[model samples]
Target: MEQFIQDWGYIALFLYSFGGGFLALAIAGAFSYAGDLNIYITVIVAGVSNFIGSQFLFYFAKYNKSYMDETVNKHRRKVAMVKTMLKKYGSFMIFIQKYIYGVKTLVPLVMGISAYNPFKYTVLNAIASAIWAIVIGYISFTAGKLLLSFADDFKYVGFFTVLLVLGILVYSFKDKKKVKKQ
Candidate 1:
């Protein structure tokens, strides 16, 4: 991963930040903490990448308004609720949408379809992106620092966590198989 980051530089980080969401951003933060990259630059690149990605989605939905509406109509209630929120909140909605788990992409697309002003959306999104990037990156960097301090102790904890995850996966898979057979 370090080699890849070295080779690709900020472009790789941009792509990762654009699509990778929380996990990818956290990993990039960890890399920055390790001196493989610059935290400030990472934050900027992530913010810009996220802004561009959202803009692209917005434009796509804007141009294909009919299709977008048709697709969203399947969830009419949810769409209406989101539209109400966007109307009532506007800038605040755009600003905090990045932190909202499922609506990160949907909100921007909905705003576009709703014909919200492009300039305002861009400004608000840029601000939100910067804040989100900085906050998440800092948290991840701090986490990396703490992890390094307790590396030896964390090995046992990591092993247990992995085992627990695997156990859950196995149980879920078995449950699914049983349901299918029935």
Candidate 2:
């Protein structure tokens, strides 16, 4: 297991973080604390990937108007909600969306469709992704120490249990949100 992580953890982190992965980054943080990965490298990988992912969304939406129109039309309400957020927060919504559970991808698209400056959004998103990576990685790394001490040989189980509980919560929350949106 340790060998597997040492070999492919960063790769997995890159792929996951590229899509605005939250939980996977936390798992990698704990793995780093456990000596399976390097914390600095882990944070860097996640941050860069997140930046690229967000930039991709922004550009994709900006350049692909026909496709975006269809997508935006399908999720008009969600897109409108993101637009409202953008209006309320301005460019800071780049940072704000990073932490939102279900709308991480939607934000960049909304910004793309609006008059948000591409270069400014890219720069702000880069900063926000780095900040998010550091904060989340450090918190999980710190918690990993306590979880390891508490779980003893069952640290893996503890991690899985925690992930499972979070998954259930997020899944249920999304369902309720979906029904409400409908």
Candidate 3:
């Protein structure tokens, strides 16, 4: 498992961060604390992948008018809500979107549809992604160090600590979605 994390962990982190982020990055941070990964490299990989993922969605919506239009029609309320948030907050929405569960990709795509400047989005997204990676990575790394200290005293205990943190994060996010829907 350590070898796998050392080998393909960053790759998995890249893909997971590109898709949804939050949970996977947090896990990587904990792993880094446990010495299974390098936090610096993990943050770098996550930041770059996150930047590319948002860029791809933004450009796809910007250039692919037909598809975006179809998507907008189908998910009109959600898209409209994002558009409203963009208007209300302006480019600040880019930074804020990374933390929001449902709207991370939606914000970028909506920005594209609204004809936001590509270069500006890229610059802002780069900064925001870096910040997101640093913040999330550090927090989880710290949590792992504290919660996983028990593992240092008794090896197997630390592994379960990591798992417990992961399960809690997953459950909390899922619970938030349910509450928001209700």
Candidate 4:
């Protein structure tokens, strides 16, 4: 991973595309700190990458609404429940939905089809993206620091293991809620 980071310098394409969310954030954060904050290149990179990925998903949902509706119709009760929740909660659903594995991709698109306002969409998504970037970036940055401090020791392995576990747990909970909604 270090070699990969070294090779690309500030670009974390591989990590953003393939790494688990937490790992990507942690690495971005660590790199930002390691570079001494001369500029927020790492943060901006991670933020932009994440925002682009998320917006792609959102656009997919927007474009594929009919298809998704057909798929969701296979379970009408679930769709009805989601619609009710979305109606009752308004824009907060977008923020809450990001915790789920793929719902981040879905909510914005789905909301676009609903009564949600575009201005609300812009505000909610931007805020959510910023928070997500900061949280992930900080974790990655701190992970890098820990690895540096204990370079010769085996604790770095444990640190990463903990990160992996936490990520899995968070994803799992999100998935579980999605299943329940379905």
**Could you tell me every candidate's TM-score relative to the true structure?**
0.75, 0.82, 0.80, 0.59
Best by TM-score: 2
lDDT of each: 0.80, 0.90, 0.88, 0.62
Deviation from native of the Cα of residue 56 in model 4, angstroms? 2.5
What does candidate 1's lDDT look like per residue over 133-169, in tens digits? 9898899887877655576578899999999999999
Instruction: Please provide, for model 3 over 1-182, each residue's C-alpha lDDT reduced to its tens digit, 9 standing for 90 to 100.
Output: 89998999999999999875788898898899889999999999998889889999989989998998888898888888888898899999999999999999799888888768899999999999999999998998889877566546877776788899999999999999999999
How close is each model in CA RMSD to the real structure? 4.2, 8.6, 8.9, 10.9
TM-score of 4: 0.59
- Which residue pairs clash within candidate 1? none
| Arranged by TM-score, best first | 2, 3, 1, 4
Encode model 2's per-residue lDDT on 1-182: one tens digit a residue.
Answer: 78988999999999999999778789888888999899999999999999999999999989998899998999988988888887798888888888997789999888887778898998899999999999999998989887657658787897999999999999999999999999
Better of 2 and 4 by TM-score: 2
lDDT by residue for model 4 over 143-164, one digit each (tens)?
Answer: 7777556654867788999999
lDDT of 2: 0.90
lDDT winner among the candidates? 2
Clashing residue pairs in candidate 2 are none
Tell me how many clashing residue pairs each candidate has.
0, 0, 0, 6
